[model samples]
Structures are given as structure tokens and as C-alpha cells.
Target chain A: MPDHPFLLEAKGLSRHFGNNIAVNDVSFSIKQGEVLGFLGPNGAGKSTTMKMLSGNLAPDKGQILINGIDLLDKPAEAKACIGYLPETPPLYKEQTVSEFLRFCAKLNNIPKKQRITAVDNAIERCGLSDVSQRLIGHLSKGFQQRVGIAQAIIHEPAVVILDEPTSGLDPIQIREIRQLIREIANQHSVILSTHILPEVDMLCDRVQIISEGQLLFIDTIETLHEYMQSSALLLRFDTEISVQQLNAIDHILQSERLADNTYRVTFAPQHDPTQAILSKSLVEQWQLTMLMPEKHSMEDVFMKILREER
Target chain B: MLTISQNELQRLFLSPLAWIILALSQLLLAYLFLTHMDYFNALQGKMSAIPGAPGVTELIAMPLLSNTGMICLLITPLLTMRTIAEERRNENLPLLISAPISIYKIVIGKFIGTLSFFLCLIVMTLLMVMSITLGSSLDWLQVLSGTLGLVLLVASFSVIGIYLSSLFKQPTVAAISSFALLFLLWIIDWASTNAAEFTLLSWLSLLRHFQPMVQGQMNSQDVAYFLIIIFAFLLLTIRRLDRERLD
Candidate 1:
């Protein structure tokens, strides 16, 4: 947490549909100017949590405080501080871009004299000036997604919530949207929920991963990066080698034969095993071909957590 | 609420569906009005010979305004079908409910937006009959009362349309259901013949209350009845949307 007071604080939020639990005891707080990425697989309570925070769905078991105001107790006053975009952008195809965005701004309670300026600011920020007069239905998918983002930030709400903002965009569009999210995160606390792991890695400052309606982890991206720096090295050789023989090399912790001529060499974190392995390979004339540390992607981290929980 | 209504009304005007319904209803009502005039012209001598004869007010504007009411009953579903149902079908109602605006504002805004379009339709039909004043003596009180009765009657009808639109996600289903419901309310009086049934069915029938007002009788009870129905349906729509937002 920073010195700035939290802009959004949700405590013990849970929602149930009939007998099924959709979100279970999720508590998280977002500070000003922080981009909190909500990571989850399908049906992992990401959307449920987002809905609760956005004041669209009331939580069954908990309270949400927006900018020090209780959301349930004072919804109208509190909700004025939020801008939300659902998984599907809510758009009226009959109206053009300017008309729809102006409606959104009005819905958010923008004042009369300031509405034009607010709408224009949003249009410029979302790169929609060219298509501002075009019907949203006629725009490409990328532009539709931009319209969704533009509406979310149109009123310049203090907290912005977006669910799967880039679920179905091309690579360039995804990058552009990521850049837009970064730009919005400068002044607003954004809670972005998406299943795409790279989206979190690219744009999020803090990450909260949920699985089976339960939050499994919440940590900084730097901390997540630390988990990716594995000490195990992947080695390939021209000749086959026994696990015990590979382990006998100095500074080696363990050895496993991965393929016909490849071995996974694990060394202690502080050990410089590459030099020792190379010298030993030359002495023993074991043709050492490739030597590199194993890189751990987010997929590996996600799979490891799921496996651990199971 | 004003913002939502403006946007909703703008969209309503942009689409040709409401325009088509308005045009068709106006043509049919104008035809009905002209035929009523022809019948009154043919019976002018007999009506003049009778004591306290039926003038153009009783002969033309009454029937024209009543016919306008029937037109409204027949076409209100088409007018209000897309109010909220289209938003749901397009998966955009979430945007509406999620806005800082309350469910009551959204429901009321939709009701007023759709009603304004239909109100314009009603006014245009009334304007067509205003030409009657150019050639003959007309009872202005009866005309005013009839117009008031039709406005209240169709406003109630729009309440039902908006409520049914909120209930279903498909606009066609909403339209059909609204017509079915309004038609049932229209003919509920026929479901009974006994005094006990008649007393209750007459009160429940949507058109029963409008006939008295259109006859130039400004009964407070009838006015209260229409107002109460409007309030009930408006409350029902607000509650339905409240529950839907949580779902």
C-alpha cells in the first residue's frame, strides 16, 4: 500500500446463485493510480467480483467502500465514482459514437456545460475522433472495444472496472488497448478482469489470481517475476548420460534425463554451475551442446498453483 | 433520467419502426374519421329534427377520438416493443443498470421516452380532427376531455408495454405479450354477464373507464382509476428491473 488512501476497499465479498457459490469471501483494496489485474480462468469469480465492486450486483455477505463511502449505504453517491465496462460492451447500434458516449457521460451525471468537454476528452483519449460520427455497429471489433473503454472512462470516474476488455482483439489491437489501460491507470485505479495471462503481465502493476471462486494469490508483478527465475538449467548433449553421473558433477543438486541426449541439471541458487559443467564436460569428453537456465512462464506458475490446490 | 430518456427517444426516432407504426395508425384513424363525417352528413337532417340532437362533437370528434384510442390499443405494442427488450437482446441493459442512475430512473425514463413518441402519434391524430372546427360548430370541452382520456388510456397501455418489455429479452415476444395483455384487459368486460361479475370486470377492463371521460364526463373516480393503474404498472416495472439487475 502507498501513502495515498485506498480508492476502493471491498471486504469479505461473496455472492451465491441458488445453491452455487459464484464468488467466495473475496477481499481486495485498490489504491489510487494502481492497476489491479484480476486474473482467473473461466468461471473463476472474476466477473462476480467485478460486478460487486462496480455496484451492479450487491454482494450477499460483504460491504464495499468507495472513496471512504459505503457503497450499499450510499449507492448513488458512491457509484458516481465508478466507471464499469462488462465483458460485452453495452452499445446501442442505432446511435453514432458521439451520441452513445454522450449518453454514457450523461448517465454518469456529467454536468450540462462540462458534458461536451468530457465527451470530447474521452473521444480523443480513446482515439475515436475519426469514427466519432460513425455508428458503433458499423465499426470493426477493435473500435467497438475502444468504444467500450471510452464509455468506461468517459466520465473520468475515480475507479474504472473493465471485464475482459480485450477478449477478442488482434495482437495490434490488444497492444493498443494495453497502452490505453496504462494511460488511464495514471490517474484512476483500474480493476481489469481477464483470463489472458499476458494481459496481466503486460499492463498490470498488481495481480490477483482466482480459481474455483477463491482468490489463490495476490502479489506484485515483480514478485511474480521472481518466481519465474528458476535455478534449474536445461542441458543438451551429443552423448547420452546417466542421471547419477550428471549429478556427480560439482555444484549440481540433482539431475534428470529429459530426452535421449538431454538432461535437466538443477544447481543451488548461488552456484555458478555452467562453468563447472562445461569444464567437466571437456575433461570427460561428454559432448555438452546446449546450456541454459529453464525459463518459467506464467502458464507454468498457473499450472503449478492449480496442481498444488488440487 | 432525462439523459436516459433523451438517448432512448433519440434512438426511437432514428429507427423507422416507430415511424411506420405512427404512419399506419394515422392513416387508419384518418380513414375512420372521414367515414364518421360522411355518416354524420348523411344523418344531419334526421339529427336536426330530433330533440337535443347529436352535433359534430357527439357525431365526429367523439367517435374519432375513441377510434384513436382503439388505434393506440392496437399499435402501442409495436411502439413500445423495443423500449427495453431491444436493449436486453443487444446485451446492453447491463450498461444501463450499471450506470450511476437508479433502476427507477431507467424504468421511468424508458416509459416516458416511449410514451412521448406515442403521445406525438396521439397529438397528430387529434390535429387531423381539429379540422372539424374549421367547418362546423364543435364542443371544445368534449374534444379536450376526449383527448385527455385517450392520453391517459394510452399512457396506461404504455406502462404495460414497458413492463412486458422488461420481462422478456426478445422484442417480438415483448410485442406479442404486450398486445395479448392489453387485448385481454380491453375485452375483460365480455368475460362476464352477471351483476357480480359485471361490477368487477367493468372496473378491471382497460377501456371501460375511458368511455365515460370521452363522453365529456370528468369523473374523479375514473381519473383516479387510470392514475392508479399507471402507478401500479410503473411500480411493477421498477421492481422487475431491480431484480433483473441483481440477476
Candidate 2:
């Protein structure tokens, strides 16, 4: 990660609304071609941090530098390197997609000569070529979201921040947008905020889970999995499995029933509990249907972090 | 700034409201011009007996310009109200704020944008006066002077409209506020006379300065008065947008 000079650096960023702290001393940076995913529950300051990063909202205390240019000291120069799409896409309903993107290109300071090609490239990239001539108000939500992203990248900014880019899209549209984000990630440093956990797994190189105005975890997805993988198994049977009988097995430290026919069995971290459980199940003929090493989902990790904070 | 201005102007033309305002105002003003022309024709017999009779320049063209100025006061808010207010309502103001542009650039860009559209309306009315070139000699200097005054006045109106639009999210609120404020500035001269020793308020009235320009008089103080109002409102808008960014 240190191999490439950082494209963005945020230090000790904090913001407040009245007496309530919205973001507190949070700091993170993105290297070139890195897509950082911001995950959080409702009211977790994800959008607040995004606003500060994009220069739409000033932090009460912090410094943001884009390519070593101080954002506060030289906002215009710094903003030139950043492109942002907020939770609500900023679009003129009366304007056609092509016209809106062209205007955005001009606003972002693309050379007027290159504006046509830049706008065309954005339309093609966001998969809006078919709807380029359509009025934005008349387009579907998915197309509007694509247009939002198209504007963000029309300038080819070094840093792109997208807040809930796929929030209201249908599943097919979400997949297309996820693919588009992946394509964008190949070239530009991206910071994406979303409630969809799998999107982080699919698109982001690293994940930052924020809760209650504080960053809870900033680590690679691989590392998150490694850190969260416990020696636990989620077992389900066609018929009921008594908890008392299940607890009798050796190496099984505890067994918590999850459903009428399912239990979450945990063993010592060092032991391979799978074999013992399989052998016992075979002996008892408990009509085993499902017994797999539990892959703790992103939701479990997020819940654990939030529970620990509380 | 130019880009923002052009986009705003382009948007103004695209909306049906601009066309309606332009077409309706022109039709109404033309009707007024013809009626005045008829009245002047009837008074032709009495004019020859007088030493210096009022001509078409005074009877028709001058009033046409003045009436068009008044129409601008009434119609400008509809055009300027959405420049920033609609952007805020549609959640597009952040696009401008986060762009590599200054708040001054935004305020000035919007001013120029609205001014350009106002210029079109003014030119359309000027053509009506240009048609007078057929029958009588026209005072080009007075027309230029009046046009300059109208420019300053419309620019002042646009600056105030942009400022109010920034403060309010709803375009309706912005439009109503601009109308009320412009009307107050227009009528302050009458209000000042009813009050005690507040004659200075007349100096603040746009009419007090505008009337002199319409009559072919160009004074530096009147120009300065309009310039000051335009500058103050534009500066206030920049400050408001800047503070909102921080907030």
C-alpha cells in the first residue's frame, strides 16, 4: 500500500451539528486505484464523513489533503481532484442526460474541447448511451443513478466519492452498477458508502465500518474474514436435535439452539470440531441435513462491532 | 463562471415561462404603444398651437421604455427565482459547491446568466422603438441612456433575486420574497415622505434614480446608487453561500 503515493489523506477529521457529534476525529486515506468501502447502520456518520471529504461540508476540526494540496487552504485546487455523488444525485430534470453530463464536465473544468468526448465516454461507461438523449426526469431511478456517477467521473478526477450509489436500484441495476464501480476502481481511487454488505465484498479492496460517529474497523476484507472466523459451526437436522444430547459430545464447549432443528455449536479454537461432530452425528443417525463450517457473514461482524460498542 | 451562466441562460430559454413572459409583455406593450399613438394623432391639432409640442419620442417611445422597465420589475423574479433555488430543491447545489469554483464565481455566474435573459427581453422591446425610425427622428443618446439605466436596474434586480434564491430552498418562496423586496425598494420614496425627516429614504428608491435616466439625464450619483445596490446584494449572496458551506 505504501508503494504508491497516496492520492488522498485525511487527518483528524471531525464535525458536529449543534451539541451532537456527527463525526469525531476520524481519519483515513486512499491510495491510487484503491476502492474503500464505508459501511454503517442508519445515522452512523457515513454521509457526514463523505460530505467533509467532498468539501460540501466543512469539518469543525480536521485537515484533508488531495495529492498534498491542502483542501482547506486551497479548496478550489483540491476540489479539482475530487468528484462526488451524494446520497441524492444532483440533476436537472429538464436537461437531457448528455446535456447534464456536458454541463458537469464544464463545471469540473474539463477542457471545453474535450468535453464532448469526456461526456460521451461517461455516458458509455455508465451504460447510459441508449438514454443519453432522454430527459433526466423521465429516466428511471437506475439510469438517474448512473447519470450521477457519470457526472462524477466526467472530469476523470483522481478521487471519486459515491454515497449510496446503488441505494434504490433493482437487483439487475445494482449488479450493473456494481460492475461499473469495479471498472471505475481499476483507474481511480474510490470511496463508496453503502448499506449493502456484499457490495463491499464484491467491489471494495478494504472496508471501513463506522458506528455512532466513530470508525469501528478499517481492514481488508480478507483480514476481516480471518479475524472473525471462529471455531463455530451452524448445524441443521431434518428432525429435532436435543441440546442436552448435543452438549454430551467431547470437544464441544457449548451448543446454542438457533432454531427447532438447528444449533450453533462452538468448540475450542485450536480443535477441528467438524470431524468430531460429523462422527457423533453419524453414530446417532440424527438425520443430519446440513453441517458446515460457519462462514460468518459481514452482518455478524458488523453486529459484533456494534454490540461491543454498546 | 461563464459556463454556469450559459447553462442558466440556456435553462431559462428552455422553460416555457420565459417565452410566455417575453411574448405576453411584448404584446401588452405594443398595445399600449398603439393606443398612445392614436391619442397623439388626435392631439395633433392642438400641438401646432403650442410652442414646444411633445413628440412621439416623449409620447410613445419614452413611456414604452419606462413601462417595459416596470414590467421587468414584475417579471424578473420568475426568471431569476430558480437560478439557485431550484438547484437547492433538486439537490444540485452541492454540485456547484463541490466543484472547483469559488462562491463568488457562482454568484456572479448566476447574475450574468439572469442578466443575459433580461438583455434579450430588453432588446426585443428596443426593436419596437427602432421601428419608429421610419417616421420621425429618434434620440439615440436618450435611448442608450435609458438602456444603460435599465441594465443597471435589471442587474440590481437579478443580484437581489439570486441572493434571495440562495436563502430559500423553495423557488416559490424565493420568487415571492424577491417581488416583495423589489416593490418595497420601488415605493420607499412615497413611504419616506409620510414619515418624519426620512427624506434620505428617497435616495434609496430605485425610481428616484431610474426616472432621471429615462428622461435622458445621466448623473454619476444615480449610477453609483444602482451599482451599490447590485454590489451589496451580490456580496451578501457570496457570504451567505460561504457560510452555508461551513455550516
Candidate 3:
């Protein structure tokens, strides 16, 4: 939906640990310069999929294409174009932040002459300049997460895949990390997997919901809401009305009393509940103050999808 | 590959465990040298009381090289306990595996870094050899040959430590396993004396192989034996790292 070329594509990607299928025929595409939010509950194969894309784990079946390059066929070239941060931050506690970043820069194959500048840029971008010399073991959880991000982006790859980047951060730290993700999205496409619903609403341009190792749905935020259509009208009445009188209307599919005077009415999708209620109110000489269709929240949709799968 | 080696070297020196190992090893070598010197003096006094006493200090004191070899065997496991084990314990193996570098390079870089630390310890113990030269008719050629033998011996044991470190993910387990393995090898050598004619265990004794070098006899077989062990273990270490990455 966003105006960008597709930077990553997974076609029938799957992973099996012995007889257990961790990821089952999952497929999705992420576009360049777009933040695609990956939402799934625990044990939903989010980490497994990310590992396959990053070349850390070979997929049992299917293909992964990075910038139209087949990952399995040309793993080195495909890996060179992407960066990944695992769910757990893989850091050596004995090493300082600067030392760890330097290792990461070299591991990513950054040129020897440019390693220092690249590491410095990552430290500045991740807001880790103050604690760059501090041992990673001594830093707080939030700063450790920042160091993890610094390692992931030190080589300046085209796509950055982060698994639960804000899993253990405080509210303020979460906000700061969210801002950092947004800043990084300007330079590279991001695939952020998180269980937090509001994070998706705040930062993601498009979302894909996966459950039970299967992709349930993929759409823009506006389109996802449209998928969860509601046929109920919420009405606030100035005059008090009995439940029996509201239910007596012939065209009413279902009616429920909200309070002393308000009522909620559900009609078929083709039926206009507001117009029907307005006509009924005029015939009954009753005043209607508010009439609006009930809209579903993203949280509601996310929960519904999860619950339905279970 | 160079970057990985540099980082491993930095970590090896920065750890407090390295300093503790160095201090303990130096203390042990000093104590062993003092005790050996006392025994040598007593033997010399006995030999002087005889009518025709050949200068046998060289032969009697040759065991010091074996003592040095034993010391190397005892300390190598501690030096290499953290090579691959610590990385796995801390879940940092993925950091190296996900890098663009090959697994062979990672293992080789770590092996060289660990060997460098062991080489430093060998240099420190050269002070003991210096003490042996004072007020005694010590054969300089024999001393030099023994020192070379000790270097090869330590290198061989360190390679075994690296291989065992890769086999286990816990540093304590790796260290204990290496100790048990080396102790068994020593016991086998001691137990095979009576049946030396048919005992294959005598051939496996690392100390037995180093004896010729300490006596100023540079046997090509001993040199080849040490080289073969080092090569075999290093190859195994490289394979272990590769298996971990694949898994």
C-alpha cells in the first residue's frame, strides 16, 4: 500500500524442528522505506521466520528473496543486504559497548578504514555515546537494548529486522526506542515484530498478523479496520424510552437498552440503522441526539483474530 | 579474521581470570623449582662422597623438564576453559555465527589467541631455567632443547583444551573433563612400566615422548608426535564450531 518497491519477499517459507512445524508456509513481502509491523503471540513462529530471513537458520522449505536475490542460492549476497537483532541481545558481558560495536562492524564486513566512522555513526544514532565505554554487563536493560540496535545497524544494511526490540524497556525507554525505529525507517526498511498492539498503531504503516505458524491477514491499518465491519448503531435519546417500545420497531434486527434513555440497535449490513431509527423517532415524536456507527479498535481486531484462531 | 583475533586477544587479557591463572602458575613453578634444587643438592653431596663420582647433575636434573611439562598439562585446561564454552554459555555464539566470517576463521582465531597466552606463561617460567644455571655445571644445549620441548608440549596440551572446550558449553565441565583426561593419560604411563614390552599405553604418554628432548636428543618421532596431536585437535575444534553453526 505504501509507495515503495518491495525490498524483501518470503515465498512459502517454513521451518520444522523434527516433527514439529515452527513456521508453516508463511509468506510476506516488505517494501523499501516502509515500516512493516509483524504481530504474533508467543510461540507463533515470529523468531523462526526472522532467523531464516537473516540466514542464521536454514528454512526447511521455500525461498527468501532479498532485493530480488534468492537467499538460499546466494546466501552471502542476500545476507550482506540485511541486518538482524535476535530476540535475546547476543552480547558478551565482559566487553565494553565500543568493543562490541567494533566486532559487529567487522563481522558485517565494513571496510577497515571506515569501521571507526561506521561504529561512531551507529553509536550516535542509537544514543549510546555516553555509555560507549562502559561494560555491557553494567548497563541497564534499556541501554543494553540500545547496544543491540547499534550492533544490528553498524554496517548500514538495506533492511533491518528487529525481534521484540522493546521487550524489556520502561515506558520512557519504549518511547525513545520507538522514535529511534522511526528515524531508522527513513534510511532502510524495517520489519519489527512485537506483541504490543499500540506500537503497531503508532509506528507501522502496514501490519501482518500471524497465528499458529500461519499468516492470518496482511493489510494497511485502515483496511484492517474495514475488514472488521460492524452493523450496529449507537443512539442517544433525549426522551426516556422503554426497552419494549424500542424492540417493537418492525425493521430492527436487534435492540438493547444502554441506560435510562440510550439504545443500541444492530441491523443487517445492507440496512441503514441510522435512517431507520431516525424515521422511527420522528413517527414516535421522540428526539434523537446522537446516532453513530460503532467502530472497532485495532486492539479489538487483534484480539479477535487471536481468539478466533484458538 | 584479524578483527576476530584481535577481539579475542583483548578479551583474554582483560579478564581477571587470566591474571589469577598467571599468578597461580608462577607460584607453582617457583615452588617446584625450589624443591627440585634441594633434591639435586642432596644427590650431589652423596655422589661426592663416592670414590669415583661422575658429574650426574645433568641426568638427575633432567626431570625438571618433565616437571615443567606436567605444569603445562595442569594449567592448559584453565587457560582454554572459556574459549568456546563461555561463548555458548552467554549465548554469544550467534553473534559470531551470524557474521560474514566463516566458522573456520573463528575457531582458528580463538585458538591462536589462547596459544599466545600460554606462550607468555612459558616465558615467565624461563626464570626457573635461569636459576638452574647459577653455581652449577649445567649443559646449556640440554637446557635449550628442554625449553623447546616444553614449548611444544604446552602447545599440544592447549590444543587439546581447545578441542574439549568446544565439546562442552559449560566452562567448569570442560575444565574438569580435560583434567580427568590428562590425569588418566598420566596414570596409564605409570601403570604400563611392568608390561612395557606389549603396552600400547607407553606410546600415548606425552612425558615419555618429551624425555628424549630433555636429554639433548632431538628425536624426529617426538617432534612429529606433538605436531600430529596439535593438528588433530585443532581440526576437531574447527569441526565443532562448524557443527554448532549448522545446528
Worst lDDT 10-window in candidate 1 chain A: A1-10
Which residue pairs collide, candidate 1?
none
For residue B27, model 1's alpha carbon misses the true position, in angstroms, by: 1.3
Return whichever of 1 and 3 wins on lDDT.
1
Query: lDDT tens string, model 2, A83-133?
Result: 999999998888899998989999988897998999999998889989999
Candidate 3 residue lDDT tens string, B48-160: 88885644335444566677678778887887788888777877776776666676787878778877787778777766666655766667777788878888888788888
Off by over 4 Å in 2: A1-4, A227-230, A235-250, A256-264, A278-289, B192-198
**Shift in Å, residue A13, candidate 2:** 1.1
Rank the models by TM-score, top first: 1, 2, 3
Tens digits of per-residue lDDT for model 3, A98-123: 99898889888898999999999999
Alpha carbon RMSD to native, model 1: 2.5
Fnat scores for every prediction: 0.75, 0.85, 0.46
> Worst 10-residue stretch by lDDT in candidate 1 chain B?
B190-199
Q: Rate the local accuracy (lDDT) of all candidates.
A: 0.87, 0.88, 0.81
Give the TM-score, chain B only, in order for the candidates. 0.95, 0.95, 0.87
**Model 1, span B1-247: residue lDDT tens:** 8787788789988889777887888889888988999999999988888999888998888998888888888888886778888888887887887687888898888888877887898789878878887998788888899889989998999999998998998999999999999999998887677635548788988788898888999889889988998999999999988786467
Highest-DockQ candidate: 2
Models 1 onward score TM values of: 0.94, 0.94, 0.86
Cα lDDT tens digits, model 1, A1-310, are 2243889998999899888899999898998889999998999989888888877788889889988889888888788888898988999988899999989888988898999999999999999999999999899988999999999898888899999999889999988988988898887889999998888999899999899789888999998787677889999999877888888888999988888988898888888689889988999899988998898988888887678777
What lDDT does candidate 3 reach at residue A66? 87
Worst lDDT run of 10 residues, candidate 3 chain A, spans A1-10
